[model samples]
Target: MTDIDPSVYANYYWVSSQFYKFRQEFSDFYKSALLYLAYTSVESLSDSFKLDLAFDLSLSACWEITSTTLESCSHPIIKSLLGTKVEWLYYILQAFNNGDLVRYQELCVYNSALRAQPALVENEKKLLEKINILCLMEIIFRTIPLSIIAERTKLSIEDVEHLLMKSLSVHLIEGIIDQVEGTVHVSWVQPRVLGIPQIKSLRDRLDSWLGKVHTALLSIEAETPDLVAT
Candidate 1:
């Protein structure tokens, strides 16, 4: 990975180190400027695919202030500039860092700013597309035909095969692609954010499992030998 420029990283590091002092040391207007700078830094970090710094910023005082105050201002371009995107970036960084690909996909949508990232520009948004597909695949652990996957992801059959292989190389998912049967046999899916529906699904599975255990206990008790009086 190409290293971030020393000067640029140093500035960001300084900002991070002194984040808590912004309110105490600076005027309201100056604090606003610093918050903007911090937001811009986060976007730049994401563009460079520097996830660590992006998260550091997200957890910084500057990001918290920006998220709370920026939208309330009267500036015309301010809302469009860092308003929705920074908030979204916070979620993106959190989800990505947590390896909650499902949550990342839930938050990841088509955005011009995301497309403008340097890494995305270089790859024609391939990473974002792959991530969206991967999110869907993680939920579809049952065997699914390649044609079905192609339909769900809006990819051609060949593209589906290539995408699955790429995910394998990255260890995003573990499964076998059956070319002859045209099915993907998935045995393992990575853990990710589980929303209400997913949680409900898990509860149902647990309830079923518990029921089976109870029935097994009943059968064992019925087959138990009677004890003689002692």
Candidate 2:
């Protein structure tokens, strides 16, 4: 196995800091395997592989991002871990077969980074939630009064304000208005997921409510005018 560069990975801080923990316990073979796994995981997310390795190896790792610990496998990462082939025969049938292995691997690394960054995930979740809420309303051209949206969504006014600012800052909404203050903020109204084509590709992979949110904003834009218009 080739030498694994810590810099190439996004989890450099944590993994590098913890490198000593696994260095001695895991044999050279195991270390090599882990490096390969990391390499393959990053690659798999971007490109298909011809080998019959299960794609889930990378996917599963990404899925386990919430956990700080390493995933458990039936076979330990001893000498047997060095090989690239899947331990289970079933996986060979499921994900392998001359596909985008590189891309899959890249995605795994991306997933790892995303998982490690809880703050980022939380921020994104908040942004998506805000987007969905605005989209749900039928008033497309007009802004929904913050108080009304806050009351309807069961979010606090402060939370609504934060989300609105976040959305506007991110350019998800075209314009915004603070009714009480008579302040109108014009922004680039680009939804994170735009149009049906993007929706089709992202719908399955995105959080369920995220799609609902875009729809909701459109609905609100279509149905309601910012009643507080000055």
Candidate 3:
């Protein structure tokens, strides 16, 4: 039997550690894939092998993974894909990350090469539904009227309600939909593998909440001086 290198085992454990970090933090599958490809001594492999990896990563980004965000596209592994045959795949990832439905539609309309992918073609409706769900997640914070969701997702109010129901059923989001009032009161969103922009958005929301709490405390203190004294 040919002897395997001990370093291969070390690299496998390292990649596993990175994946664990990803689950706990904001990193995604692409980032972990990049780490594996970069550190696994795959530099000696042929271009075809790298291209295969890119294609698999793109497919995972589009359908296989639960995460819609692809914030790490600027990484070297993805960046090197520029001007390559899979360049459209890069833009597709960006569209998903940003929840740009119009851009995604445009790509599908213009890029016949993208349309040729059997998996994407077969799952077209599923992909559209996933993107719409991602669009809802991007826009929703706490509570939103159904009309606004319809406008944002480019779906009818009825469709919006159905979408929310599907999202709820899948545990993608936890919320209550008020058909009477035509609104959704979202209590939680599933944590996604985020990029820097998403992380900053989260930070800004936290700061805003802190500011509001501080203002409320000041108001309470001013209105109840006797209570504070007691």
TM-score of each: 0.44, 0.27, 0.74
**Candidates sorted by lDDT, descending order?**
3, 1, 2
Query: Per-model C-alpha lDDT, please?
Result: 0.52, 0.40, 0.75
How do the residues 54-93 of candidate 1 rate in per-residue lDDT, one tens digit apiece? 3234333222221122222222222232334455655554
Backbone clash pairs for candidate 3 read none
Best candidate according to lDDT? 3
Error of 1 at 134 (Å): 2.7
lDDT per residue (tens digit) for residues 1-230 in model 2: 47766545535433542453344322232333345455444343322332322322322322222112122232232223234433332221111211123332343355554345443355555433533344323123354566655654456777767656765665556576675863435444443213244346456656666878999999888767664462
User: Native-vs-model 1 lDDT?
Assistant: 0.52
What are the root-mean-square deviations of the candidates from the true structure over C-alphas? 12.8, 15.9, 6.8
Candidate 2: what lDDT? 0.40
What 10-residue stretch in candidate 2 is worst by lDDT?
91-100
Which segments of model 3 are wrong by more than 4 Å? 1-48, 68-76, 226-230
Task: Report the C-alpha displacement of residue 211, candidate 3, in angstroms.
Answer: 2.4
Query: Which residue runs of candidate 2 sit more than 4 Å off their true CA positions?
Result: 1-141, 179-188, 191-230
A best-first ranking of the candidates according to their TM-score comes to: 3, 1, 2
